[model samples]
Target: MDILQFEKQYLRLPSAIDEIHDELFDQKGIRVFVKRDDLIHPIISGNKWRKLREYIQIAQFNGYKHLISFGGAYSNHLYALAFAAKELGLASTGIIRGDELTSQSNLYLSQMESWGMNLKFISRTNYQKKLIPKEIDTTNSMIIAEGGYGKMAIKGVSYITKEINQGNFEHIICPIGTGTTYLGLCESTNNIEVHGILTLNNLKEIESNALEVGIPIQRIYDAYIFGKYAKQPEELVNFCQLFEQKHQIKIEPIYTGRMFYGLYDLIRKDKFKPESNILALHTGGLKS
Candidate 1:
């Protein structure tokens, strides 16, 4: 089956909106809702699929046979790409950071290998430069950047704004990694506020991305990163567990947990106006 057919028959587009009620939101006279992009697919879910959709389409249409991308040992982007390439009848290569790692390093890498993705482990220094293997051929290949960060990714993520009923909400917020999703929302919206909660200390990078896209980097919050990316502090882990118990929805500390924590703190600090309706995106990296 083709990419369009696979998407139509399997992937969930325009993912559902779920209203989450809390006493804190009630006290603030605000309503909080979650854009359930996680429900898009069990594997290629959330912003992963959104960011990769256009890239896959372009590869298929332009007769590219191989899809190459960069990531770490447990990269959600690489996992999604491997599965997508397998399903779409294309080849894939994952240039993984950490020369010590291999297909046996973890279950994710093993799974990617099972999906026929040629995983090449590289040194940290070489990975920083995104150097591909000398033996690997680039002919008829589409190389996607780490975490799917690029103009095509921004274009893919921008569709979220169109999927959402923007008129119903005063603000839309997401976690910023490479800033693709945040920039896309900002580029696509005019009247509604686009807020970004930093999952890592990449504020300057995100600002540069926004500037490149000709969007204002006005509403990015930097106080919530909790030292660095993938830290998984005790408080954050606890919050994620409690949140799942309360809302019956799963969230991971790396991204969604940080975003939700920041959102709650912002509400407690009275950052938003009363009666405001805010939408938080669940960008789905819940592999565990």
Candidate 2:
């Protein structure tokens, strides 16, 4: 389970931020840049890819035949985990949050099932009450906590800090789901303002958890949630379509699209100085 070897063999991804220049930022009257973690490995890419890499390594090292985790119906983490586990020759299971299975929403879940992932849908109350699935054989199996699984999940986020250090940027903005990526980015760097836009409402618990990990972060904006997790607004849908047309990049309404919308709003509101350098993290859940 040499992670280095795994990285070399399966984690070769492009940097999506390659050609961004001042001209792009000038349109918004602020100096803006992007960190393309989205281009990391196609399957095991983005924050989810980095966060799960070590967990997969540990599971394989421990000779686990199965990997179990949690997420919602359209969870990027679940999607990434299913694909990564299949790629690494391991069994995978997803404990989804809701019981209702809509035809439109079950496409990804069906795909995961096709990839040999066992899908279990639980009630929201039951899902929260049961953080770790009870049926799993913990003796030989590894259960990766959803949303980056604490400090160990920050390995991939450290790469963003390294990239920023190599460039000249004062502030970095990214969407906050479980706050794992935000924690990793903040802990791995200094002198840069880390702004997390909450993708869900009621993130006080996540904030406390991130602070406990000693990650300095500022919650500068929130995605308005639209009601709850995975819920989207017409504005967001329109923005997603417009963004893809302009940038030739597809963004899911769940995370990246919301963050981009927030960023644009912040710039429109004159939240940043025109001369300031800002870097927005494309945390890459676009494939949704």
Candidate 3:
């Protein structure tokens, strides 16, 4: 594979939006449509592609042959980056957050290794502050932040807002991990109310980061985190299963499920009156 092929997206662009016919939304006088970004690819789909697109191009343009990044044991960002690096024929190094995960075997970690990404395990303490060990030299690497949160990421994520806004939805709903997607939507849209269902509990930090980017959490739902990040309550799991059975669209408990759960909770509270058009951004990572 060459940089030219890497420059090509190699996946379907501008995914379709499916209108969900459910009484749960209809009775609330809200019309919900799901943006199927997951269909962009079987692996590198959704916001992952949006976040990485420019980074990949920049690395290739700058003559960088490697990509380095950070993530947790079950990070979809790492998963997508590993595969994207493989597809783009670029070398990658993944600095995982926990040192304990090095001894444990999991599909996510194994797949990253399979994609030829060198996996470096680090203690959570140093990982939080210093990140990777200094022995691993990344002189020619383009480093991507965890969950793809960076300035260049805003450029990629902004495309989602530009595309979704073309349909004229009153509200945009998405699951937030690093607030990069939410920030991009805020920077790109003019009239749409971007509502983020935060997957993590760091509201103060998220708001601070957004404010640093010139937009605060205008409308965010923090009640649906289910105690902490990546925790799947029994109720949320059941709701995800039932939602898949009803809508025939699979959603994992990590991101998309939490967004749907929060959306339903808001609807129950009469968040939206009748005749409100809502668009749910399905940011994918169904592998969980």
Candidate 4:
């Protein structure tokens, strides 16, 4: 399947970096800009949209009756996949990672199920094993890695370089989960430095993964893990709420919020020079 063909079906989101000019510079005392990939698509927005678009196209072209993927209960990827699959007339099965379900998380899960996505819950141990269920057909059905963080996920991230070229930013920073997005940006550019503010505590593993990509990543800052992925502290939540109030841009506590927090800290520690034009890629997953 030609990924370029489906590009026309989706509306390209306009960059929203202009709106936060004052807050990013004057209020934060840092020359920060944003690559608003969050607005890429209304239904399947942000990095997930970019990563999944081609995979969905491939599945359709291969005549897949069902699309099976992996994610957690509150996975933005799973949610977006459910919506995109319904739109493309394909059946979706989401293999969720955890067992715990709060009221809010369950509500979103119910919505995805209502949208015709088959929801399957597995033991956390099994989820960590990263085993693909045998019942699902791997021939025609495309299995998108959880969080879409593999090499295949880099396709969506390659678009970031085009945006950077247009803006002429000196550096790019993004929240790091599986490192696919950061690696994509690193591969797409030469001179610009790409930083990934890791949300996970185990920096060595993520750093190793980044190195495995064989791309020049400027740095990986794991100082603000906020007690691991999806586990947020009061300060992190408060910071996210305050940022939303100030910028009116809602950021998820796990990823973007931590990156923003780290960016602020870096500025406070005199890490970023005032003259440096830094671009922060808002790889939005706030809804999840």
Candidate 5:
């Protein structure tokens, strides 16, 4: 199948927006809505599909038959890429960190292998350097950065703004890992406050990335990164559970959970002006 056909058949573009209710928001005269990017697809859901679609188009356009990317054992990026490549009749390779790990090391890794992805595990040092293996062939392959971070991804993510009515929202917010989604929002939106909640202590890195791309960094919150990336503390876990119970929308501690937690804190603190319409992006880390 071709890339356009695959997108039309499998992907949900312009994902739905749902309004969330809370007494605090009411008290503050603020309206909260969530962009349900998680509903885009089951496996390749959220910003993953948004970030990968452009790369896939570029690959097919240039006659590339393979997609290669770097990630960890349980990387959602790799898992989604494997499934996307399989459905689109393309080859995929996942360059994983941690040399001790194998394809069978975890369910996600094994699943990637099952989807016909070539899993190459490398040492942490080499992974940091993003070294490609000597055995793997790079011809006709598109190398995607870890977490789908790149200018192309920023372009893909900017399409989210096209899906949204910019006039209706006063502020837009999303969780920042590599800052691709955040930067994309910053690039596309005018007269909207783009807020980023750092999932990890990478404020400096995100700022550097923004500056590199000529995006002015503003309203980035660093106080909400519970401890570090993927820490999953009890407070965050409980918050995710209650959030699920309250809204019936699933969220995990790694990304969406922290974002919502931080958003709620900001709301309570009156960080936003009264009567502000805020849109929070649910970037789907549930299966990652």
Candidate 6:
């Protein structure tokens, strides 16, 4: 599909899915289906699009001319909102973490700015304390919480729950960065087991983020975090390369790759019985 056609259609619908025919999973007595939310749109793909769709609509409908949000250097949230805002003809400003970046810090930031997102750099401490509290100037502006995980996004993320409810899957698994999508999925289900895989070194802080969404964690796998957030150690890189080659599904180290790796680990341990059907969400932050 062309970019414009897909973008316009995605705002009104959920992304498609693909079923992998890997014999390893089949021999292990498990069925794996990937919810390809990553293919929703190139820039505003996956959970980022789900998290930002309604916020952007509310911004425009509420008569706001500008949207201000916070994120790190390669945040998918900022990258998505920048392009979505531009598509909707609304102005956007990204309060980026760290005051150490030049105009050419990286390609993601550069694309954000090129798409009409005004960049504002702040120290990490201030970014955590001030901007995270939504203290940005609000003159005709909508203040988006970090990672676009505020209440506004819960509705969109719940779409996953709705889809999963319609499927025969016994368990749902997703990568947990800030736990927004996990919570959204959790809020709409009662019986299905939801597994969240950590992609950062922070277990306690990640738990807190999950709690902020009011989702009680049962099992969160953190063994595959590699080292820290955004750190692409050799193992993770090599694993992603091999997995993509076999599955033909594109994934990055920061999120989906870790989740898939962790999923295979659990399967190898015989954690799921032959009666179990699993759905892994491709949450999509490869652009980051």
lDDT of each: 0.92, 0.75, 0.85, 0.76, 0.92, 0.81
Candidate 6 residue-wise lDDT, 1-288, digit = tens = 332454566553456667777777888978888998887777788898778867876776678889988888988899998998887788899998999985489998888999999888888889878553345456899988888877778777876677655458889899988777877777776677888898887678767766775767766788888878879888888889998999899899889889998998999889888868888999888774
Candidate with more favorable, higher lDDT: 2 or 4? 4
Task: For residues 242-281, write the lDDT of model 2, one tens digit per residue.
Answer: 8878776667788888888887777777777777788888
Residue lDDT tens for model 1, 179-272? 9998888888768898899989988888887788786765999999999999999999999999999999999999999999999999999999
lDDT value for candidate 4? Answer: 0.76
Off by over 4 Å in 6: 1-12, 132-137, 165-167, 209-213
The per-residue C-alpha lDDT of model 2 at residue 283 equals: 79
Model 4 misplaced regions, further than 4 Å: 1-10, 19-30, 99-105
- Assess candidate 5 and give its TM-score to the true structure: 0.98
TM-score of each: 0.98, 0.87, 0.94, 0.87, 0.98, 0.90
Which consecutive 10 residues in model 2 have the weakest lDDT in total? 14-23
Q: Could you tell me the lDDT of residue 71 within candidate 1? A: 96
Pitting candidate 4 against candidate 5, the one with the higher lDDT is 5
Comparing 3 with 6 on TM-score, the higher-scoring candidate is 3
In candidate 1, which residue pairs get closer than 3 Å at backbone N, Cα or C atoms, i.e. clash? none
Clashes of 3: 0
Q: List the residue pairs that clash in candidate 2.
A: none
The stretch of ten residues in a row with the least summed lDDT in candidate 4 is 1-10
Superposition-based RMSD of candidate 4 using all C-alpha atoms, in angstroms = 3.0
Clash pairs (backbone) in predicted model 6: none
